[model samples]
Target: MKEKNANSQSDSGYQRSLTNAHIQLIALGGTIGTGLFLGVGNSIRRAGPSVLLIYLVVGIFLFFLMRALGELIVSDLSKHTYIDFIEKYLGKDVGFITGYLYWFCLITLAMAEMTALGIYFQYWFPHLPTWVPGLITVAVLLFINLLSARLFGNLEFAFAIIKIVTVLAFVVLIAFMLLQGKSTSYGPVSFANLTAHGGFFAKGGIGFLSGFQMVIFSFVGIELLGFTASEAQNPKVTIRKAINEVPVRIILFYVLAIIAILVVIPWDKVSTNSSPFVQTLGATGLHNAGSIINFVVISAAISSTNSVLYSAGRLLFSITFNEKGKWNQTFGHLRRQLPQNSLILSAFMIEFAPLIIIIIGNDAFNFISSTTTSMFLIIWCIMLLSHVAYRKKTPEEELTDFKMPGFPVLDYLTLLFFIAMIVLLLFLPENRIAMIAALAVFVILAIFARIWRKEKTE
Candidate 1:
């Protein structure tokens, strides 16, 4: 066997014991949980069964996006990830922007997932303080993050399993209910559920446009492929396989799951209480419906929280790699070649913010989404620009294995879609303030970047 060297340190202390099944389901878990579980009604209200169309449209765009990143990252065995590719294809300035913005994406994603967990626990322990589990969950994830890369991989594998099984089980139970001719006050299971109420696109053109924001939110963390590039056993093959299969997985897990739920409950009647998963399964009068989905969601949230910390911690580690960062070059070196110091720091900050949020007792979704919405848009913009640069820099011939299907057209559509999502966000009553706040965060981060650069020059 040839000497097997470790790649860059973005995967944290975790290494690549993850098998094909592990990577696929972990990718599934990263994107499928809390949002799809709970946000189904929100999507329906925006586009109705038309939201199913939205899922296909958005999933296609994400497939191209992931393939673009995967095509570039899979070339060498160095474990250099998409962030590294950004630096290589674009200038250092562009790379730094991508890396920093991606870091924000990771942490804010963690905050969002952790926020969901706190809310779930409050269901059972109604009298107990919300922050107690928030505090404890953060602590536990932080400790787990400090271990070697494979340790983290194993943990994510198990966490992702909980979600996959629950969703599959939920689908089966829905099928069973429909077969039994079950009826709710809403109506009975009938083929008409697909076409009867408002004829699929019940909300019309404007509602369909408005639904993309939540649809994009459902697909947020699927970029775990880029983050895991550093530790994939043979990213040359593993990342390729993972990225190549993006389209099918998105359709199967997200699209199919949504179809299952819509068939079981009319788009008009799905509840906002708990997850749509709970409402669909609970209708079956199965044993402990609330408890079953609550457990699945809890596991999904924990998996999301864990995966984000691992991905974000690695990006934090990269900052010190710059000659300008406070840590010496040695800081970039991981013991046993893992990202120990960076993981510790990233884990601390991630946990700290939520404890503060918990202490403040501001548990509303909009409160957290405001800070993150801007952060997410900023990252999306960076990734889009990075791809443009990649297309410009990389020669045409070596692009053989995989390239985005269309040059400027598909890429441009995806870009425009992201812009429209941001615009739609402004129209939302609860999210409107967040849209405004996100603008301010962008300005502040830009100004901070300028000042930091000036100080480096001085």
Candidate 2:
């Protein structure tokens, strides 16, 4: 299938120890996280049952986006990350900006997960300090990550399994409850709950539109499959498999799970302050159901933080690889074949989440999450543009078998979807500040890129 060193080891010193199973679960781990567990409540509060439509729309576009990325990864497997493809096809300037921006994106996302960790812990230990759980989590995850790539993959494998089983069980329980016509405090568990509450568009068009910000945030780490390309055992097969399953993952993990929650609790009744999963389970009057789901959501948040930290570390290493300067030299190189320094630095950055909590208090998670959603939307737009440039520049005969479906058209559509979402964020009163801040970061990075280029030339 026109392979070009598709299984070759990366020159960047990453070990290809992650097998097909690891890759699959890591993809699952990335898709289902604090965004789904905790953030879904926010989305439900905003859009009601219409949030399902939002998830479907975003999922379809992202699947196409991953196909474009899979083609790039298989086309030249030796590249360390998607940023390398960006640098090659879109020019070093764009690469420089995107690399740092993506690193910041992952870091911000990690912070959001950490913030969620505090909230999750509060369900059990209301009197404990909010920052205590996140601090301990970052410390433990950092050590595991610094050990080796395979170890990180193994940990994610276990975390993903926990999440999958819990979600599936929840869905099945809800279905059984519906079939029996069981009644909760709210009402009978039935699909009718989806439509009975405000006729599905209870919040109207603006509310539906508002859900996109957090729903998009929930899908932020989906591209983590791209970062694992270098470390995956068989890049072409594993990455393609992972990317191809995006639709299924979206349906199972997001669509069905959210449906279960809505059918049981009604969208308007779902708690915006905590995980709706816990709330739904509690409504069933199952003993310890609330506590059990709370534990699962905590695990979900930790799993997300772990995955993002892994990506953040690799992103930092990729961005600084072989660059000049003391900081670059410190974080750019791997130790014992692991990106130890880079991971440490990324973990260090995550420690700021607690400090952010101190400053913004309860608003920290939403603020950090909104900022990440804005940044990632911009990053996704750039990645799609790079994919388009790659196709135009490369000869038809040289392309891989995994080309993006409906080339150029679907690509442009995907780009438009993301850009429109960005515009939506800009207009939303709550997200407007974060959107503008993201744009400011982009402009600042562009200026630095110009100056860096000029300095190199002189």
Identify the candidate with maximal TM-score. 2
Report the lDDT of model 1 for residue 74: 57
lDDT of 1 by residue, 1-458 (tens): 13234442333444555556666656666767666765566777678888889989888877777766665565543534466666676665556666666677677667766776766777788776645665678778878777666777788888777777877777676677678887754568665797888988888887787677667767777777676766665556566777777777777678878888888788888765457777777776668987878888888877777887888767766655645545635456566666777677666666655665655564444356445655576566567766777777667875546566677677778778777767777876656776777666566666776676778789
Q: Candidate 2: misplaced stretches above 4 Å?
A: 1-9
Instruction: Give the distance in Å from residue 414's predicted Cα in candidate 2 to where it truly belongs.
Output: 0.8
For candidate 2, write residues 1-458 as lDDT tens digits.
33324344566887777888999999977888999999999999999999999999999999999999889888987788899999999999999999999999999999999999999888888887788899999999999998888899899999999999999999898888888989897888889988997889989999999999999998998888888887876778888888888999999999999999998898888987788998888888989999999988998999999999999999889988999999889989989788899899899999999999999999999999999999999999999998999999999999999999999999999999999998999999999999999999999999999999999889
lDDT score for residue 336 of model 1: 64
Model 1 reaches what TM-score against the true structure?
0.88
Using all chains and alpha carbons, the TM-scores for the candidates as numbered come to 0.88, 0.97
Clashes of 1: 7
RMSD (Å) per prediction: 3.2, 1.7
